[model samples]
Target: MIVRIMGEGQVTLDDTSVIELNTLDDELLATIQADDEEGFRRTLGALLDGVRRMGTPLPDDTLEPSELILPASDATLDEVKQMLSDDGLIPG
Candidate 1:
């Protein structure tokens, strides 16, 4: 799930979860809201890119959804569990 925040006050999740800012999201939200457009874009791009890289490997336990994220639609608490199931790049 790729989460992106734009300079025009928009939040896009998985290319569908698009919404205007109603309130803050997290520490990330604070950063996005406070920084200049270019700076925000660069930082958010880096963070989002890092998360996208996490799904490079297929999980060993394919039957268990909990075991891997597999490019899912939403952010669940099982994220780390999912990443851990990957054959490459153990979750930190």
Candidate 2:
């Protein structure tokens, strides 16, 4: 799957990486529901970092559509909250 980090370019992630991302997404949802800004920040940073570490960076010239769009590392809880869907950012 192709994941896009807002303000960053796209990265290609395999199925295993997608599963990992889904787990992080769940944690993020929990933090949002709990209204824990610190947890949200930490989890969001981890999620973005995981993507950066596990995903293969796509070339800028690539035009493929992204399957998921994630918030930036510095994204505020409110900003990320607005981006969440019923299935979260990355659907299982």
Candidate 3:
């Protein structure tokens, strides 16, 4: 899975990481829905960190279509809220 962290390029996460990503996605979605800024920030950081850990970074020139596009590290709550989908950031 090619996951793109906005402003941070992309990473190719393995298929095995889907469930883990979904968990984080669901958590992030809840935080956003509840307007929990602290939770949102924390979850976003974890999610991004997870992606970076489980996936290999793609080269700058290897711009392939991303499977998921997450908010930037510095994204605001409102900014990330607009990026959410019914299934959250990481699709099932």
Candidate 4:
């Protein structure tokens, strides 16, 4: 799956990576629901950082549609909440 990080670039994740990200997404959603700003920021950073570390970067010239779009590292909780769906950012 290809995930686009706003202000960053697209990353291609394998199935195992997706599953792992899903776990982080679940934790992120929980933090959001609980209105834990610190937790949200920490988890969001970890999740985005994990994607950056684990996924392969897609070339700038590549035009493949992204399966998911994540907020930037500086995104506020409200901004991320707006982007969330029933499945969160990364669906399992």
Query: Which candidate leads the pack in TM-score?
Result: 3
Task: Name every residue pair that clashes in candidate 1.
Answer: 68-82
Q: 1 or 3, which is superior by lDDT?
A: 3
Candidate 2 on 1-92: residue-level lDDT in tens? 99999889999999998887888888987898899999988988999999999999999888788888888888888877666644366443
Could you give candidate 3's per-residue lDDT for residues 1-92 as a string of tens digits? 88899888999987888677888888888888899999989998999889988989999988999879888989989887666644456442
TM-score, each model?
Answer: 0.29, 0.87, 0.89, 0.88
TM-score of 4: 0.88
5-53, model 1: which lDDT tens digit per residue? 1111112233222121112123234443454445444444554454444
Model 3 clash number: 0
- In TM-score terms, candidate 1 sits at 0.29
Cα error, residue 62 of model 4, in Å, equals: 1.8
lDDT of 3 at 33: 88
**By TM-score, how accurate is candidate 3?**
0.89
Candidate with best lDDT:
4
Worst 10 residues of 2 by lDDT: 83-92
In angstroms, give how far residue 47 of model 3 lies from its true place: 0.2
Worst 10 residues of 1 by lDDT: 16-25
Model 3: lDDT equals 0.84
